[model samples]
Each structure stands twice: as structure tokens, then as C-alpha cells.
Target: MPLLAFWESNPDEVSQTSIEQIVAMAGDGNLRDGSLCSDELRQYLTQSDTSKLASYVEHCLSNSFAKGGQVLQDLVNELGRRLDFKVANGRYQGTVNAIGFDGIWLSPEGHTIVAEVKTTDAYRIPLDTIASYRRKLLDSAEIAEPSSILVLVGRQDTGELEAQIRGSRHAWDIRVISVDSLLKLIQLKENSDDSETGRKIRSLLTPMEFTRLDSLVDVMFTTATDVEATIIHSAAEKAETSDVITSKETSTTPSGWEFTDATVLDAKRVKAIEALAKQLGTKFIKKSRALYWDSSHETRVACSVSKRYTKGSYPYWYAYHPQWDEFLGEGSRSFFVLGCMDLNFAYAIPLDILRKNLSALNTTTTERSTYWHIHLSETSNGLIALQLPKSSRQLPLDDFRVPLDQS
Candidate 1:
């Protein structure tokens, strides 16, 4: 069976398998460019989550296997794609007439990086050959003059390679980083909510003079601040929408309205989202604290969790942010999924219908954000319904209840 097919059939076994074992199971056990094995492996990598990618990278670097070097090359290019770069995979074998680069990564801002992957820097690198590839690309206009070379080595101990690059003429145009650092970047980007932080992470790859430490410090500071803000917003009862951008009239939560503290409901949020994913029949990738998208980015969902209040007829309350509106707008199919009480019961409201009646909902405004308040309760007919503010008619929600079944 092909590696991907086998993985789908035997996820637990494949999850415990090493890179060598996986390669052995793949078609022909060969990973040359354009081969069936290579195609299957790359497809498998793309479909796998970030954590799986990190594990595969570790296996490739730690164990020796047939065609391991070529596998590492493909892994590095996949890392490039995860970093939001437009990646073009280079050939497995270099020919005299052809450029021998491992990959070409194009940034959104038009900068180019010719990437090379090496398991070790113990042997002296041919800086001239790597530079020549860049030159050829520049001459053919395949890459612009602002292009540079990046060498991703397997080990963090690159003292020998560092000295070699410093002494070489290509030192100004070449930068070296360990695969470990690259994986951390992927993890960081996946966890972060700020898009600017992603831009800064990409900037670290661009060839630059690091003699002055200000730019590096700025990147660190920005990343730390954004991560801290995300944590605070997730935990705060009346939190600012730190990840959102808004410009609107400030309002306050209505008196007697219930507030769902995120900290109290966070544990249930994960299972709720998982249930919603199953209901929608899509594998969703986390984008922020409450936002997710499918692999194709075609479907988006913002899931909120609330504890059921004992005192009120409308027992559940959830805050809906403008940021979620913007997020859902980008998707062809979007939903605001609300999990109440034990979370066995939930409503997946269509964004279009919810958006049309947003004006009828009450608002809670903090210094940094203004969000709508959603209330849910059981009607006299024992059906789920959305209780609108200002005595507006309760909207029937029975049609939108998401089934929380293992099936």
C-alpha cells in the first residue's frame, strides 16, 4: 500500500513508525524527484499536521536510511510552504546543465531564497557552486538580484560551517540555519495570531547584517507581546480583542445580561470544536484561540463555549467578535458554533443569517473592541432558540443543532 493510504488505514501504527520504516513502506522505497514515492511522501507531508511534520524532520535527521538525503530535501521544501512562502522543489540530482538548488522560496514581497539542505556541515561546502546557482537564476530572471542562498543544516553545532561562510566571498549573500530552528519557526507561526509576526519570522531568513542586534530584538519583542496578548484575551472575562482590528462606536453590555467567562469554558472548547469538525466533515486547522479553517481554507468556523446559567430562561451567553465576522467573510461556508452546558448540545449558526440580524443583538464594548452578545435557551416547544435583545422574536435554532456523535 502507498504510505498515505497505509497511514489513513493504520494511523496509530504509522504515528509510532520512524522515517526509515515509512520510506520502506512507500512505493518502491525510493524518494527521487518526480517518482511515485516522492509524490506520495510530499502529499503525505502536506496533509499531516505541524506536529507530525516536526516528528518526521527529527526522524530524517536522527536515523540513516536509503534516500534519506533526498527525503530531507523534500521535508525542507515542505517547511518552506508552511512558512507561507511560494516554494518550487528543486531536483534530487544535479546535472551539469541544470541548477543544483534544493528549493526556491519566494516571499510575498518578491524576495527570493535559493535553499540547500545538508545533514551535516563537517565537510567543507562548495560556496562557489551554491553562489553560481543564484547567479544563473538571476541571469535568467528566474530570481531577482535581491535573491540570496540559505543552507539548512541538520545539526545545531554549525561552528565549522559558520567559519567557512565568514571567510568565503559569498558570506554577504548566504545564511545558514539549523533544521531545528526552522521547525521552531513553523510551530511559532502556527501558534501565533498576529500576521505581522509571521512577516517578521520570514524576515529572519533574508540575508542581513546581524552585527547590530536592534532588528532581532524587535522581532523577539513583537512575538512575545502578541503571544502574551493572545493568552490574556483568552482568559479575560471582558477581554480586549487583541487580535482584532475594529473602528466603531463604543457600547456596553446590557444590565442583567449573562457573561460567559472563557477560562471557565476553555476545557470544553476543544471537544466542542472537534465535534463541530466531525459534524462538518472537515479537518480544521487552528488559526487563533477560537477560529479555524479547513485544509483548503474554504470553510471557516468560530467556536465559542458558555456555561449554562441556572437563574435565567436564556441559560447560555457567548460573545461574538467583529474579528470573527471578518474571518467568516473570507470563507465560502462559515459558521458560528456555540457549545452550551455539558457541550453535548451545540448550535452551528450560518454566518449569513446571523450577520443579517447582528444589529438586533446587544453589544459589549471594551476600550479596544465592540462585540455582539448571543443568548440561547430552550423554547416552550423544547427546541433550541436564539433569544434576541430588545424583545425581538426568538429565532428558532433547532435546524442548526450540531450532532455530537462518534459516528
Candidate 2:
């Protein structure tokens, strides 16, 4: 008998025939060239107009539930705003894609608290998926050690959403709520029509479904066993080390310092200043005399000298005192008791109070004792002097180590 006639006679066998045909055709070398003999079956399935089939496929893919993922994402974003939590959705890490929740809260002792969020539907919550999320939480050290809160939401049969608090562990808590409640909250802030619609849809979800969802939420939120803080810390440390190495490799030495002047400018000192500048940018300026930088707004820094200088006696030293008055002004502020040092050493002083303090310093050197000397304000353009030793004075301006200007 012919294959179609035999299959028609034994209807139950027809399914197997189609499967075998597909498998055989798929394995054939000529399959790509459309030479495989599946035209009869293809024509049967496609007997309907192509446009109709396309429309049917599109309709299937565009169902309400299929589109609900975006609604959920929006809800997550809104919740984050209300709770001051950081929320991100559809993030991919390695082969896995997930939503990330981050936030900081104050503990009873004022310590910083952190939290995470996850979601599920009426269907069974997969253990592996929950575990994977927990693993991710454990991997992010900044969020791992802080107290965590997990939130689960469910839709109800009555078309009204409901919420349940699954559990709370020490600083951590697991909570569940319905979309209706969220809508109501939103309604309180805005329009009532949306709230009413939300309430209606929330009513469709059964309580039992929500309860089961709450159980999953509880497990995900309350259970601390899945996440290990130590693991996260270790990972963070390693990552930090790797980042340090990578940074060193990519970083170029600043152009301002030359070799001959390098000795006068302590490599360690310049690096420290550069590091500060890198972090604070132009907000900080290094005081040439004190060998320390000051915030732009700060004026006088408390400095001590081991030996008081007799003003006229050290006439030659006046040139070395650094045009302090040029950089620091009279209106600058002062910090107290920074340290005791010698005339040869520089002290960081605020720009505003420089003149007031300079006037206060005793002109004559007393016993080799600590005394505060006011820095002078000299520069109008808020330039802090970087003093080089006399021998290194001629070094090019490019030899001074300064941070690259990102601005």
C-alpha cells in the first residue's frame, strides 16, 4: 500500500510517520538545499493561507501573561522607589539572567542594612532558581553581609491582590504582597481608575495560590543558609586585588616629575598627593611649604615649629618660606595642633586664615619648642606652592607629579 494510504488506515501510526520523516530529513545533507522529500507533509500542514498562520502565531505569542513580564518589571522599579531600594531587572551574569535588588537601610544601631528581591508566579517556584539568586547575593560582598529582605508578590482570584510577610531573620526579612495592594498604594498617590482596575485583576487570583507563593517567598527570604558572607568577602578581596593589578597596568606615570627633581620630591609623597587629587580632583591643592594639600575652602592649618625663627636672623630663609601669603589668604580657616616641626619643614594651612595666623607667630625664635606659624596668602588664583629644594628649583614644570585632568 502507499505510505499515506497505510497511515490513513492506521491513524494512530500517522504521528510516528511524520516524526520519522522529519528526523530523516533533518539528517540528510541535501536538507539545506530543500531536496529532501517532505513536500507532501509540508503542503498538508501549510494548506491554510500563510498570512492566517502568521497571524495565529503572533496571537499566541502576544497573550496577556506573556506581556505581564514588563508589568512586573515596572512594579519592581516602583517598589524600589518607594522603599529606597536599588532595583534592576533582566540582568545577565554568566549564563544566567535575573533581576537584582540593592539598597541600604539603617539598623537599630545605625549600621547600614542591605536587601535583595526576587519574584515568582502561581506555579511551583523552582528550588534551583531560588538557589541561584541566593548564590548571586552571596557573591556580591557589599550586599551579602548586610541584613536582607526578600519580597514576593501574588495575584489573587478575587481580582484583588494580597500580601503576606513570610518571615524575618535578625536583620533580614522576607515579605509577600499582591499587585492590588501596590495599585492601591499607587492610587493613593495618583489616579483612582488604575487602582480600580488593579483591584479587579487582583481579585482573580486565588488565596491558596498566594499562600503557596508566600511559602516560596518565605523560603527564599528567611533562609540564610544558602548565602555565605565569607564567600562573598573572599571573592570581593580577590576581585579587588585583580582590579589593583589591572589599574597599575593601565595607569601611566604623571608627566610633571623629572628624574633630577625626583629626589627632592619624595616619590611616596607625590604619589600620595596624586592619589588625593585623583579622588577629589581639583578640589584639593597641595601646600608647597607644608608638603600637604589643603581643601580649597580651608585657610589656616595648625603647624608647630621645633625652633622659633628670629625674623631678621633668617633673612635668607624668607625666600624659602614659600610665598605662603600668595596661596593662602587672611580669611582662611584653621585646624588645631597639627604637629610640631622645624622652619625647614612645611605645614598645611588654610587659605583664608593664613594672614591672621602668620601675624600671631612670634617673629623671634625662642627655645627649640613647638609654635604655630600662620601661612601667608599670596596668590589670587588659588594656587598652592609646591616647594622644590634650591638644587632642584630649575627642574621643568613637567617634572612635578600631578594628576591627569579628567575635567
Candidate 3:
């Protein structure tokens, strides 16, 4: 069976499988520079969640195998993809004619990073050779001048390698980062809502003079602040109430549902994705906190979860942000999935339909942000509808309800 099929069959053993074990299940039990096994492994990595990727990285770093370094190289490239870079995978092994870089990551702002993966810093690296690869890429116009070399080491204690780079003539053009730090950056990017967070993470890979620590501190502080804000917003959402105008032209304020648990919103959001993934017959890898996409990049979904409000005609409320809209635009087929936690159902609204009704939706604008308010109400006849502005007609959500049961 293929790697994905094998993984599907043995889901529990995937994390425990070593590099060699995974290779044996691929093409001919061998991993070459441009072989079928390499292709299969990379595809699997692209579709894997961050947890699986972290596990595989641990397997690679625990003990060296026949093709362990190559595996690490591919994982690092996938990390680049998660960080919103346009990644071009490099060779597993260097050749005489081609550049010996492991990967090239192109940022949205037009900067480039030439990546090199190392299992450890026991031996000194040939910084000149890595620099020469960058020069060759620049000469051939494969990468522009604003490119720098990144050495990804397995060990967090890279003292020797740090000394070597600091002493070398090419020190200004090369930077070093541990595999642990790289993975942490990926986690931060995956959870962040700020659009500029990815750019700042990419900036950490480039060569920068750290004589003054203000710039570095700014990146860390801003990212942490944004994450904290997201947490606070989620907590505040549970207690917030809004007036829902009924069909009879009467406005009534709803009380927030009394709930003791903190993780229910998160759980419902996860279930929404799981239920949609089964219905679509394809696995979706998370691209961001709210956005997920299939391996083929053809389908994307932005999932938002809402708690049930008490004593109102409309019991569910969701804040749809611009970032989710932008993320859904990256795919050919996209959906804005709203999970009503109490109703135990979600509406996977097509992007085109959502776009058409956006102007008729109610929006809440503040100094920091603006978002459309999505409200779901049930009728006396046991039907759900999307509540729109009083000027527009409400939309029935029964047809757009995502499949919640396996059958």
C-alpha cells in the first residue's frame, strides 16, 4: 500500500514509526535524491498535522538512520510552507552541477532564504560552500540578492557552530537556528491571527545585526500580545450579549449561556472540521487557527465556533473576520463554516453566497478591527435561518447544513 494508505490503516503507530520504518513502506524500501519514496514521503509530510511533524522531527533527531538527514530536510521545507512561504524543495544530496542547498523559501515580500539542514554541530560546516550556493543561485537568477543562508541544526546547544559562524568571513550572510526553535515558530504562526506575524517570523531567518535588541524584542512582544488578545477575546465572547431583532419587529436582549467549561468552544470547532473532513472524503491540514485546506489546495474551510445564547430568538452569534475571508480566497473551492455548538450542527456556506450577502449583514466596527456579525435563529416550526439585516431577507440554513453524522 502507499504511504498515506498505510498511515490511514495504522493511525496509532504513525508517531512511533521511525524514519527507516516509514521508508520501508514506501517505494522499493529505498529513499534516493529524486526517487518515488522521496516523493511519497514529502507528500505525506505536506498533509501531516503539526503534531505529527513534530514527532517525525523527534524521530529524526533521536538517532541517525540511513536517510535521516534527507527526512529532516523535507520536514523543514514543509515548515516553510506552513509559515506561508512559497517553498521549492532542494536536492536530498548535492551534485556537482546543481546547487547543494536543501531548500529555497520565497517570502511574500520578495525575500528568499536558502536552507541547509544538519543533524548536529559536531563537525564544522563549510560556510563557504553554502555561500557559494547562494552566489550561484543569485547568478542564475534563481534567487534574488536579498537571500541569506539558514542552517537548521538538530541540537539546541549549538555553541560550537555558533562560534564557527561568528568567526567566519561569511558570518554576515549566514544564520543558525535549532530545530526546536524552528518548530516553535511554526506553532506560533499556526496559532496567530495577525497577518504580519508570518512576515516577522520569516524575518528571524534572515541575517540581521543584533547589536541593538529592539527589533528582535518587538517581534516577540507583538506576537505574544496578539496570542493573548485572541485568548481574551474568546473568553469575553462567552459572556457577551447582543440584541436580536425578531421577525415581529421586536428587539430583545439575550443572556449569555451559563457554562463552566472553558474548552467547549475549541472542542466544537475541532469536531466541525472532523465532521466536514469525513463528508468531503479528504483530510484537511490546518493552515492557520481558523483555516484548513486539503492536500490538493483545491478546497479550504474557515471554521468559527459560537456558543448558544439564552432567552433570545437568535441563539448563536459569530464574528466573521476579514482574515478568514482572505484565507478562503486562496483555494478554488472554499467555505465559511460556522459551528453552532448548542445546535450540534454547522453551516458550510459557499464563499460566493457569503460574499453576496456580506453587504446585507450587520457589522460591528471598533478602533482596532471590524467584523460581520453572523446570527442564527430557529423558527417555531423547527427550522434554522441566517438572520440578516432588517432590510434584507433571512436565508434558510437547512440546505447548507454540513453533514454531522458518519452515515
Candidate 4:
């Protein structure tokens, strides 16, 4: 029968046939010599697309096999003959009709090894699943120890064979081989065409199937292993500091200011501002609720500070009443600094001198330079400084000072 015919009929049966063929081929010394089967069926299962056997096999062979089902059947038959293994189609085991591994293996040492095979992704196989298979084999009263092996056959950029043994209790050895290797072997046999056996073995090998098998193996093993440690570490480092303030907040407002009721600030906004501040080399203070540059010449700024109503509803008139009035009306004395702005200067300027200048500006109506008004609003929670117009004359002395001209 053609290999395509068996593949189209049923995946389970196709697998069994292929295993038988491989065993025979090995026995004939056409493939490789080994005392026991190399569990190639498991590898085939991992590499084969069993969901739609006909289409998968067709795809693997690039539709070269005219009769899809027959091609698979023929391949398996040839493999069995070449490996010198007895091939059986459907073997019954109690309630289950084991299509994949119904055939009995007659070892050279007179040991009969019964095997079950599946083609699937490597990572998807759970330890529990392997345990279940072990239990099923034991329950069936098949050969002792069962000698189960899992084959993970996939492709890599470069064709190279790799193997690893896995399994906890029973210790099932796993071998990972590249599909290229199998294809190469088949190619070699085909090229020789020395005998009928050679032609049959060569006909079963296809490059496309080897490529598909490679993809399956890659996905499986890659997923099964632990990866992404570097990414995790990078993310962890960034999240360590919680209280860093940022530059955006400082740039948004004028200097030496502290905000009261800062808790009202959105968490995301605060984080963004903190990040900005770090980049700008500005100072961020949680206690003062302010962002400022370390240099005395820089201005400080703060955000939020209103005495608004609490988030929830309050009693009767209290709901309509301003929270500040309500608290004060109730004889509660609470003072909050909404926000404060301070000028940071390279040279210290006395607060007394600043106050004198402020008083002179308030009293004088004579012609003066750019006049500016610095308005500060007081709230129950804190003081808030309103933004001053550019024309407003409340310029800090530091703005007017300059070092000696270099020219």
C-alpha cells in the first residue's frame, strides 16, 4: 500500500503502520541497528499533524503523493519490511481498539515489546499524561516495564540531532531529533536504488514532512523550558521605588511650592510626574507634596489642595454646603496648605527684603516697571498659589541678577 493511503485512512492506524515499517527497516540494517525500537513512533506523533491526517500528510509531501492515504500505508509497509518488524493493523485491548500500537514487537532477544505512539507538541505533554500512559500499559498486562520512550522530533535552522531523557518515576528516556536526519536517511536510500528494498525506503522519505516535524519539535521544547528571566528581572528593578516624584509637575507650576491634599492626585499622573522629575534632576517630597529643583535658583511647585467634599454623601445640609464651611461652621479648626510657591535663588534673599518690596508695590501708584500680582488662595487643607501673568511684577530678585559680563 502507498504511504498516502494509510495516512488518509486514520492517523492512529497510520502511526502503527509507520512504526512497524521503521522496525523492519532497522532490522534490515537499512536505517540503523538497535536492540529495541528507538521510539520513533513518539517522535512521529509529536511531528505529525494528527488533527487532519490526510491534509497534514498531503501538506508534508507537498501533494506529491497522488493517493494520500495509500502513500502513508505504503511507507509504513516498506518501513516494516526494511526494519524487519512484524506489522499489525488494529489490535484490540479490552474496551480500547489500539490503532497506533496494536502490533507486537519480536525482539532479537525473544522479548515482545508492545508500544503505543502519539504525535503531539512536546510542551503540551504534562507529567500526569505520561503517568496515565504508564498506567494504561501496566493495566493492559503487556510486556513488563513497557520500556516507553518519547520522541521529540522538530527542525532547527541547521540540521542537527539532539536528545534528552525525561520522566520522574519510571524514567522514560526522551530523544529529540531533527526531521532533517530522517529525510537525509530516506534520501540516501533512494539515491542508491540498489534493490527493491532501497527503492521502497527512498520513496517514503519527504523533505516537507521533515520541515513540519521540525516546527512541532521547536514549539514543544521551547515552551516546556523556563525562559524570560531577563525580562522579569528588568521589570522588577523598575517597580522597586514607589515614591519618586517627576519633572512634569515641577515644570507645570512655579517654584518652592508645596501642595496640601495631594492625595487627590491621580496615581498614574503622579507616577508620570515622578518619572519626569527623576529625569530632570528635580526634588520630589511626599511630606511637602511638592516638586522642585535642588538648585536654590529653581522654583518649586505643587498640585492639588482644595477642601472639597469627601467622596461619599453627607447628612442633609452638609451635602450642599462646602466642606470648608461645614467644618468651620461646626467650630472645627483645621488648616491646610493647598500649595506654596517659593523662589530658589543662587544667592540667599532675605524674606524681610522680599516683604518690603511687596509692600512698596501695593502702596505705590506711580509709574513702575512690569507690575505683577501674586495671588495666594487659602483653604482649610492648604494654601494654593494662583498662576501669575507674565506682566505681573512679582519677579524674583534672582531673575534680575546677572554675573559680571564676560566681554
Candidate 5:
């Protein structure tokens, strides 16, 4: 990856042309007109431990090629391997550079399954190729009914392909599935450890990592469930009763502020928010999953929106919902920010943000570069962070729009 560090740092160097060339070269198994599958390249890679070499292979596949032929085939092979595909030694033609047949499997029940791996954005396998795979599998064993599966990686329009396959008059049966579908099958297998049939059903269901942590934290509040909303509302009510948020300071108290049951922020709403901010014609830095700019009164505006908020915390998920702080390389210039959770009550500022401002500052923690341990009881300057007035004009937190120039 260091070989690409320089180019990746300057996005200008990684043009569409270079990306295409990289993908082609990856499929061709070449670098600098030299074959990476050659003994020399293999020796060089072998100089490092297998794990590092595997990482390097993955990096090259993911970063350089954007995923391609041999790279995709290896992944497909690995998926089959990890799942303990009943058929071992499933190679065909024994091509070098991992360019052999994608995979050939014999399910425990004696059904032969032949798979063809593809990593193109849009590709249509000819009917002849499907026939050839069926013939090959039948020849390899005494199986009566042989089925074929086309495993596509990153191809978005697989539905059309599947339909075409279904309609085709090819001699044998064939099914088209995206790698994502296949992965779902694998995951279901992992989850359903009840019986072999259950696991196989998972395998048959078909299948998929990567995450945007900052974006995830920002959307965390949007996905909060009804139960979670009840808890949050109860917390707010307790604060009000305890005079933490005195009724005298209330401006626009919300009665039932909740969102529909959705865990992910809608993409269209995110675009709308961005477009609105762009209309303001002010430069705003988008970082830490929050939009940051200075308000009219010199107060820093750190605002984020949650289109969906799930009810519970997932593994590696930061807590405190809309006002969550993910010390994982996320920093805040604004002490107390606004959380637009599920676009319910625009004035219903998140308690977590307030808690963050009042709690001990962020410090190093396991999953993040910085993490905060917040408690609502903590306050500053004799002000109860949670009890802050829900005003329309008193502060910049009331509006649902991005604050770019404090307007």
C-alpha cells in the first residue's frame, strides 16, 4: 500500500484512467509489464510472512484494482473454503496466478454445483459458457442434475442478469447471484448453528464490511427504537421535574418527539441538507460526521442529522445516540453541538451532546482515538447542559438547516 500512499494522498494522481489501468493489470497479473504470477514476484512476496503478504494481496485487490479477476476468484475461493464447501480440490484447468475455474462444488447430497466468478460492473455471460460449465461438472462426476451459479462481485445490475438467465433456453439450469447475496448466505450459516440442513439452507440463501464510523455515529440517533426514545424522553422528563430543565426556561417543549421505525438515514434527506447548506454559499468543514462553522454570535456550530436511529448499540457502536462522541479520530471544535435525530423535533437537542460538554474531555480508548465518559449530572458555569432552553431564536440549535455563516 505504501507504493500507492503517494498517489492516494494526491487524489489528482489517481485518475479514472489510472484506476482502469490498475484494474486491467490486476486481471492480467502483471506489474510494470512483468507477471506478478511469475516466480520472481512470488519470491518477493514470500519474503514477508504469510499474513502480511495476505494483507498486501488484499490491499492490492481492494485499492489498486478496485477488485478484479484473480482477486475476485481468490475471494470466492476463500468464501467456499471458509464455509467448508463439501467438495475439496475443486480446481479446473489448473491455471497459474489463481486464474483457474472459479469453483466446483459437490454438495454432500451428491448435487454438483459449478460457479463462475465475475467482478465486472456490468457483464453478461454467454449461454455457451454456462453449458460448458455444466458439461465440465457432469464429466467430472456421475451426478445426474448439475446446477450452475454465477458469482458476481460488485455488479449492481444483477437482477436483469438473473432474469435473463431464467429466460434463457440453455440446456442446463443456471442462477445469477451477486457476491453480496452469497455473503448473506455465509452469514446466515454462521448465525444458524442448529443443524447441517440449517447451515446449508444458509449457504443456499446466498450472500457480504466496511463501515463509515463517523457517518454511523451521526446516524446512530436516527435509528433509536421506540424503547430508546422512551428512555430518552423519560430522561428529559426527569430533568424537567428535578428543575434541571426548569419550566421557566422552556421555550418550545416537545411532547412526543419520535421518528418512524428506521435505522438508516435516508440518502435523499442527506442530499437535501447538503444542498440547502450549499445554497447558503458559505464554506463549511464536514468532519467528525458533523458540519462545523461559526454562528452569528461567534459560537461554533457543530451540527449533524440522523435520518434513522436504531434502538440498541451494536458492536463498536458509540453510545449516547445523536449527541454521541466517537473518539475514533473524531474531534469537536464546538463544545455543545446540535443533534437532528430522525428530523423529529428540530428543537429537541440531544442530551449526549450536552453530557459531552459537561463530562471529562475525551481521552484514549480501545475502539477510538478518543472517548468520553459522560454523566448528565456534570455541569459547567452553573448551567445544566440538559436543561438548556429549547428556544427558536435564543441559540443556533433550533433550526434543522446547516449553519454555515450563522445566518
Candidate 6:
């Protein structure tokens, strides 16, 4: 409860500046004494001076460390307020910091948006917990008639919430939507609307995360390259456990599954990699680009998975250089290639092997590190490979390692 602790310890700080003001001050690396934040959060906030403001919002919104009911409510309230929606119902008891029940937004489209912001994993709103909201919306026939929905800002799956609502014996009202997905959708709406008002609205949106989310959706969902990559990746998966390498006798692969750059930047692949990491009982990092890291191993390895139609030639394996640079800069030494869509396998270069090779092949280090073309086709049994079967429940981490250790 660092969040709580920080607040308690820094009553003076809390009183002097608002969270946003603190964030702004932190961005300037000027967080005064008695700041209500942990060291990690302080560091992150300080770094925000160089990063986008939206980065701060995304970090706060997504991370476990920066969350609380009040925190979530503040963010949601700001989002709704900035979206120019009227709070038909809100937990804001008006004492500036006293938060209450929840918020129901009356959108510009006359739709009532119910936002349940929860940062605690231990807390899931039960059917009974939502009765007040249901009554609030239903009792007011005028508000209920206008496309009301309970958008769950949850840390986990809200499918159960949806199912519960659907199965309830009442008016078929208040559909459920994920806050992250809904956030993206709302930003998408803002992006799609090219009107002057839309432009003005975008300019006015605070914290810059709304704009950032919109741009991310625009690129990942609407951009031409991302679309092609996603399509090719999907088709390749449906076709087979992608053979990323032909019999090219690559240095990285024994089966000649050539280590090439295939950009799998979709959400599904990311989630799959994350789930696999969870099952492996290790940490997973999927953010910003085509790189995912499995720190589950003693040595963390950055990876790019294939999901494209590469035929008998090189698959469209791509390394988002910036992502790799960031990953490596974040202290990952080894790198892995995974057939995340179909084959469910990962090949790796040991840290020593990678360092030595990158040094030898390093005609241009910094420039080359920015983008990965993975040219290690020597395959002298130096590379470590991890073969992930359909079910890895019984397989220990060692089972996937090459030179298979009997121990």
C-alpha cells in the first residue's frame, strides 16, 4: 500500500499540491519534499519530463502500483469531464477530495455511460453491489432510455460481469465494456471525427493520454503496414505452425527456421505471450512495439514472434529497433524468436553467444542496434532453442532449453 502509505506520510505534500500538479512538478524533476509517491513512481514521474504526458497517464492507468479506487475515479472523472460529458451521477461528494460511489456519464450522444473504476484485484463488483447503479439508471426512465452501459474499468476479465448482468432477471439494460477497450474506442471515435470541434476537443483533452491512445489505435488498427502485418500473420497461423525458416541452415535455428523479422503487433499475440509468461511463472513485458520479453528465465530474452506468410523464403520477421533498444537498454542481454501464433516455440541466443556475435558482427553498433536484422545463420549449435508444445503444463523451463539438460 505504497499509495496509501505515501498519502499518509506526506499529508503536508498532499495538502500543498494536487496529484496532477505533483505529476507536473515531478515531470520537471522537481517533486518537492514530502511527495506522496514511491521511489519507483517518483522516478517514473521525473522521467516524464522527457517522455509524453500521456505516458504518465498510461502508466498510472495500467500499473498496479499507482492504483486505488480514488485514483481510478479521478482518472475516469477526468476522462469523462474532458470528453464533455455531463456526470448524471458521480461519487464526487464535492469536498474536492472526498470520492463517493461511482460515476455515470451522460454523453453528448445522450447515452448514459456507467464507469466502474477498480484498481484492486481483490475487489470485483458483485451483482448486488451494482444494484444501486441499476436502480439509479432504471428508476430514471429518462436517463435509462438513452443507451446506458456499465463500462468496467477492471484489472481482469469482465466477462463474468457481463454474464451476470445478462442473466439477471430485469430489464435488459446496461451492457458491459472493458475500460481499456472502451478508452481505445472513445479515442478512436475522437480520431475518426475530422470536424473542427473534434480537433478542438483533441486539443483540450488533458494528460495527453486520450490523444496518445487515439494515435496508437490509429496506427495499430488503421495503419496500412500494421494491417498487412496482422493479416499475413493471422493467415500464416491458420495455415500452419509457421516455419519461419526454410532449410536455410541459419545460425540461430537447427530446423532452418530462419530468424527473420515478422512483425506481430496485434493485441492477441501480445496477450498470448503474456499468458504464456504467466503460466511459466515469470514476468512478461509487452509494450510499445513488436518485442516481448520473458524474464521467467534466469536470463531475460527479448523476442519477436512470427505470424506471417513467408513461404519458402525469409518470413517478414521485423525488429522494432526502438523497442529492442529500449528492451536492451532496460538490461536484457539475450534475445529469442518465437512462433507465437502456431508452433508455440522459442529459439534463443545465450547472453555470451549474443554479446560475442554482436561484437564481431558489429561494424556499426548503435546504428545497427536500433533495428534488428538477425543475421546469425551460422547454427554451430551455439544458439539455445525452446520448443513449446501445445501444452506446457508439465514441461519445466529446462525442457525447452537446447543441449537438453537431463538434470
lDDT (Cα, tens digit) per residue for candidate 4, span 51-130: 22333433434434323333333333323222223333222222344423433433323333333222223434344444
Candidate 3 residue-wise lDDT, 242-314, digit = tens: 4322332222236432342336655677788878887777778877778889878789998887666665556
TM-score for all predictions?
Answer: 0.80, 0.24, 0.90, 0.24, 0.34, 0.33
Whole-structure CA lDDT of model 1 = 0.78
Model 5, total clashes: 18
- Give the per-residue lDDT of model 1 (tens digit) for 1-407: 88977886777898888777777777788777678877777777665666777788888888887788988888899888778788889999998888899999998777899999999998999999899999999898888857899999999999999999999999899999999999888778866666667788998998877789989998998899878766555445333222211113212347422334445455466676667777776666665557777766679888887655455445666778887898899999999989875557678899999988898898877664788988787788878788777666788988888766555
Q: Look at candidate 3 and give me any clashing residue pairs.
A: none
Q: Which stretches of candidate 6 lie over 4 Å from their true place?
A: 1-57, 61-67, 81-84, 92-101, 120-124, 137-144, 194-407
lDDT of each: 0.78, 0.31, 0.81, 0.30, 0.38, 0.41
lDDT of 6 by residue, 1-407 (tens): 34324434564564455454444433233333233432323333222211132343455556554233444454555455434466533543333433234676765555565556655334445645455555655666635654444545544476655565667752254455444654554454332212223323333221124435775454444434434544443343333434543333222435333333332334434454444443444444432234444322133445455543445323333332344444445554444434333334344444444443342231223421333333212123433222222222111223343221111
lDDT accuracy of residue 177 in candidate 6:
49
Residues 114-146, candidate 2, lDDT per residue (tens digit)? 322233344443333443454565576534443
Candidate 6 residue 98 Cα shift, in angstroms, is 12
The backbone clash count of each candidate, in order, is 0, 48, 0, 67, 18, 15
Once fitted onto the true fold, the runs of candidate 5 whose alpha carbons sit more than 4 angstroms away are: 1-67, 87-100, 140-146, 197-407
User: Across residues 1-407, which tens digit of lDDT does each residue of candidate 5 receive?
Assistant: 32233333443443323323433433244432234432233232212222233344344345645333554454454455334354332332343443234566655455555667665436566757656655755676533463554444445467666666657775235555666555555544432212232334423423101143553343333333323543453343333222222132223338533332222322322343334434443223222223332212122233333222222221011123333332211433333333333233222233344543534332324321233422221133422122222221112243333332232
Weakest lDDT window of 10 consecutive positions for candidate 3: 243-252
Whose TM-score is greatest here? 3
- Report the error of model 2 at residue 380, Å: 48
Error of 3 at 393 (Å): 2.1
User: If ranked by lDDT, best first, what sequence of candidates would result?
Assistant: 3, 1, 6, 5, 2, 4
